[model samples]
Target: MKVDKVASSPIPVSQLNQPAYPQTEQPQRPTSVRPQTTIEQAITATAADQLAQLPDIDAEKVTAVKNALARGELELDIHALSSAVMRFHTGHE
Candidate 1:
């Protein structure tokens, strides 16, 4: 407000509030994407079913071992089973 110790009006800011040229249309915006893919939906459903079954299993594994055990042909790999269990608990794999 002071120039050479004199009081005077400041320049107007009304000219600064608007664009120099007119705008003709609204700006374009990107569209939203799908919430989930088909594969993702399938995986979610499978995981849900697995959880709802109360117990987890590999069905093919059980079937393969079934007849083998019945015929006394099943073999236990203690080291492999122990390693798998350790990996599951430790999330190392």
Candidate 2:
């Protein structure tokens, strides 16, 4: 019978002395990009301009809306209605 010494294998000297692999380069980004205005600012500016050019409010339309609200005939989701109204009033749509 023969016995083998398996743990006596030698490591390469090149591997021991070699430096680590270089890292990959990343893409450069723009440096002086400006931030955009908020939705509220845009809405306000548009609404102000539109309102300045509008004629006097229609009394009939005001009365119709008031009557509808008083008689529960106007079923409105106020949040959605307000958002839509703001868009229309602002000429943003």
What lDDT does each candidate get? 0.81, 0.86
Q: Per-residue lDDT for 65-84 in model 1, tens only?
A: 99798888977788898989
lDDT tens digits, residues 1-93, model 2?
A: 998877653877677776678677898889988989999999999999999988788889999999998999988788887889989899664
Maximum-lDDT candidate: 2
lDDT score for residue 81 of model 1? 89
lDDT of 2: 0.86
Q: List TM-scores for all candidates, in order.
A: 0.36, 0.30
Clashes of each: 0, 0
lDDT against true structure, model 1: 0.81
Worst 10 residues of 2 by lDDT: 7-16
Candidate 2 error regions (>4 Å): 1-55, 85-93
